[model samples]
Target: MPELIFRQPDGSTQLVSAENGSSVMQAAIRANVRGIEAECGGACACATCHVYIAPSDLLLIPAAKEEEEDMLDGVCAERREGSRLACQITVTDALGDMIIDIPDRQY
Candidate 1:
């Protein structure tokens, strides 16, 4: 399992264990981490699970697909080079200690 660190908009952080092969959104939902609404339940249909991956961890995970990229256009937060949909990032050993920042609002 990999450990994920979520940095909330309020400057608080939630650390959770993510099972390999599971989506980051799934782990956040399981741990009840705030800021990740996951309205589409990891379907990549919505931007509610938007997160900013740490620049250092960017290469650890695969790049977002076209569908996820398209959905990101609707995110309420500013989209940066590190922005990614949590539902599109699968937990893997390569991502041993990933850190993501949640926006202030998803809606």
Candidate 2:
């Protein structure tokens, strides 16, 4: 199992094992991490699962798709270079031990 490190808004971190092939948002929800709402249920329509990929881990992730990029415009936090929809990020061995920073708000 891959380790998923979730960084909370107050700077606290929670480490959880990610199920194989699950999205980051799903894993967070399963763990009841509290920050990711995933209102669209992994659908790209909502940016409720917005998160920021740690700067150190950015290159490992694929570039954001157009739809996701567009939806990000609605996120509560201003978009940054590392911004991404947690639902679009799948857990993989390469992404094991990944670190994701939750934004201040989910809407």
CA lDDT of each candidate? 0.90, 0.88
Against the correct fold, how does model 2 do in TM-score?
0.94
- On residues 1-107, what C-alpha lDDT tens digit does candidate 2 reach at each position? 99989999898999989987898889999899878999889998889999999777977778889999899988888789899999998888888878799989875
TM-score of each: 0.95, 0.94
Per-structure clash totals for the candidates: 0, 0
- Best model number under lDDT: 1
Best by TM-score: 1
